[model samples]
Target: MANEYYEFFCPVKMVAGFKALEHIPFELSSHDASRPLIITDRGVRGVGLVDIVTKALEAADMQAIDIFDDVPPDSSMITVATIAALYREKECDSILAIGGGSVIDTAKGVNILVSEGGDDLRAYSGTGVVKSPLNPFFVIPTTAGTGSETTNVSVIKDDKTGAKVPFVSPFLLPDAAILDPRMTLSLPPKITAATGMDALTHAVESFTGLAKNPISDAYATAAMKKIVTHLPEVLKNPSDAAGRLQLAEASTMAGIAFSNSMVGMVHSLGHSVGAKCHVPHGLCMSILMPHVLEFNLSVSSENIGELLLHVAGSDVYASTPVAERPAKAIATIIALKEEMYALCELPRKLSETGSVKETDLEDIARMALDDGSMLLNPIDATFEQALSVLKKAF
Candidate 1:
């Protein structure tokens, strides 16, 4: 039976396809923004994507934009303050984020400070604390994972306390997202595979979580279908523009789906593993996803069973016995993992991550039990159950 109620909300406007980057000028202009502070990291800047985007802006008579290319992998309050100061000094009117999760989140943090009129971003750390909309923000993702472009939450690390601070508000979501195939065309094979798994995890967890509803399910399934088909294609042929576009779109859809419906145990443990083991978040998700789904089978069997149609082709879904579809779905996910591992050696177990030891599993499980995502899990796993899943993943 369905839940009594659910809510879905996504205000980010998506402009996708070839030459989508060329549309940024018009998108910013519509928001009355001309001088935008471009936020990116060295990796993206090194790839000369900044030059490509800048040329697009200059073509549209936007030549006075400011660029900040020093954002790090883990953004901090100091980083936010420094970028915010630059935005203020340059008198930038808007933000154009041109990279992945860290870069986009830094842009959002800068927007908060510039709009809310304060340098201490930590003050706004909590849910729904940002009451007013910030400056117009546009995101051009260089990676297809994270879905930070469409999510309403941003996490900035506190340099002094070594704590991850969270900021969440409807206003935090990007006003526009550009999903050009060219943006992801340069991704390495392993990154492409890991990020694709990240998107799949987002869609799957959203579909199986307690808050799922019809709208989120539609988006989740659609995203899963896109990922199942296009992820491997792009991995096999990085130059495939159509496949890249599908993955980019799938990531955004998964973001919208999970942002509304929320995620469950997979994310709970994945976050813990990432924090504890310093593994790539997508790699962590890929390792833990099947295990968590198996753990949730008693409660989420029907939901997991239904995912088979979306993850596998319709022929496989139809031929599988209805009673066994849930287990089949889990097997299919593991098969996808195997395929990815074959292509890129994407780790299929905690042991392969090199950073995670068996001794660390207890701490990861304890941390996962305390994670907020656990609240939305179909089953309220105790520490022992959580540890069991980690052990199985290990």
Candidate 2:
């Protein structure tokens, strides 16, 4: 029986295709914006994506007012301050964030500061604190991993404290998201694998978590199927533009799915580990997904079993019994991880990440208790339970 109550909202307009980058200026102008401040990172610049965006802006006769490309792997409050100051100093009226998760997160943090005119970002750190709309913000993701282009949340680190601050509000959603295949064409295989795995985790957690609804389930199912088909294609042929676009679409869909439905213990554990050990979020999720899947199977087996049809394809799904499909789904994920490892050396266990240690497990487990995403986990996870999962992952 369907539930009588549910809610879903996704207002961000998306332009997706081969040369979706060319529509940036048009989209900005439709919002009555010019003088955009382009935010990115050195990695994007190294791949010539900045130049590509610049050319697109030029061709549209709406060149960016300035560019901020010093974003780190983890966004910092200091960087947000600098980007905001520059945006104001240059009189930039819009924001065009280009790059992966961190760069888009940095841009979101900058938008909060510039639009809210705030000195301390930590003051707005919790969920739904942003009462007003942000600037004319648009995102062009250079990697098809984080789906930050479509998400309503941003994670920025307090450089001094080394603590991650999450900002969530409907206002934080980008005005538009552009998914251009050219942007991710140069992404290396290992990064491609990690990011694709991240999208899969987002989809899986959203579907089986406590807040599952029809809209979110639709997006999550589509995302899972896309990952099953296109992720491996991109991993096999890194230069496949069509595969890259499909993966990007999947990531965006997964982001929207998880944004509305919320995530679960996988994100809770992944976030804690990344914060404590400096492991990349996607890598942590990739290593921990099967473990968390197995843990949640007790409560979410039916959901996971149904999802097996999408993740494992027809033959495997048809051969597996309904009662046993959950285990098959988990096996499929483990096999996917092994495939990634064979192709690009994606870590299958936490110990293989080279940053996670036995001593760090206790701290990560403790931190997991504080993560807000854990609130939506179908099964409550105590510190001992979290630690046990971490040990198994290790």
Candidate 3:
């Protein structure tokens, strides 16, 4: 049996719906942060989503002091320092990040530098290294994955060493998370599928991992059901506003779930593969989820079995035998991947991702063993086991 003692924490005030972007100015004013620095990437700016945020802020008579839209897909320590310098140069009082995970993570890093008054990002690299209150921050994620808007962690890559350093502190949590469907409506089909699967991976891992608690389980299950129902719905009907909103909300719920309970081997391996192969995080997550599920099924069969009801529907659950439900649940996830692939070429195998090479399996497995997320896996994985899973996944 899993340990009975556990704790949950998610302090983000989420404003979700079709036009939730409009409420950002009010939320910022509540924190007395009118001169906000808008942080984002060029991808978001290219789609004019930042314009939507700026227009809304203007309508509320609270325009941003400056907009930094040069954030890269992998947030670097140098980018964080540059953003902090810009924050100070612009005389900004708060941060309003408008993009995906990297943008939000960069904004969090900037907050750490701006509020704590330091140029050395290495000082706040480890878990809980930040002890002071951060500047007021809000996040508007244009992607339906990553849930970085609600999590209390930020990953900043070291430019000099190419190492990813994690920073964990409650201060990293945003004061508010705005989930507006308009922000994500223009996301490409491939990106939409990958991000949705990333959210599903988060839900599944958080639900079945060793640190699972009642509160986290509740959020995870809810997130799983929503993803199963809405992911395909939005895929079939890209303009389905309600479906997009549901996916976004599910992503946030999954973020809250994993943020509290933590993730497991899927994340460990995904992070390693992503770093080593330069594969997109969500694409790596989407491909590796089923393999991780099978690896963990021996220890978490009952929990995995319960997810069948959510993923495959009630009729399938009612007809399947209890003893066979876990395997069926794992199949359901694979089937989900196949269906997504049919819709938008979501890579089911690592080989299809174009970046992962055959010879990289050993190095990837070694990195997986070093990942902190591995500690929370339902079953401890040996070097041989991790390598076997990687080869099988390959």
Tens-digit lDDT track of model 3 for 23-46 = 988898899889999999998999
Say which prediction, candidate 2 or candidate 3, comes out ahead on TM-score: 3
Question: Looking at candidate 2, what is the lDDT of residue 184?
Answer: 88
Q: Judging by lDDT against the true structure, name the best candidate.
A: 1
Q: For candidate 2, what's the RMSD?
A: 1.7
Order candidates by lDDT, high to low.
1, 3, 2
- lDDT of each model, Cα atoms only? 0.92, 0.90, 0.91
Write model 2 residue lDDT over 217-327, tens digit each, in one string. 999999999998998888888889999999999999999999889899999999899888988888888999989888888888999898898798889899988999999
Candidate 1 structure quality by residue, lDDT tens digits, 67-128? 88999999888999999999899889999899989998888888999999988998889999
At residue 382, what lDDT does model 2 achieve?
92
Stretches of model 1 off by over 4 angstroms after superposition:
1-3
Candidate 2 segments exceeding 4 Å error: 1-4
Clashes of 1: 0
Instruction: Tell me model 1's lDDT, rounded to 2 decimals.
Output: 0.92
**Error at 98, model 3, angstroms:** 0.6
List the candidates ranked by TM-score, beginning with the highest: 1, 3, 2
Model 3: how far residue 348 lies from native, Å = 1.0
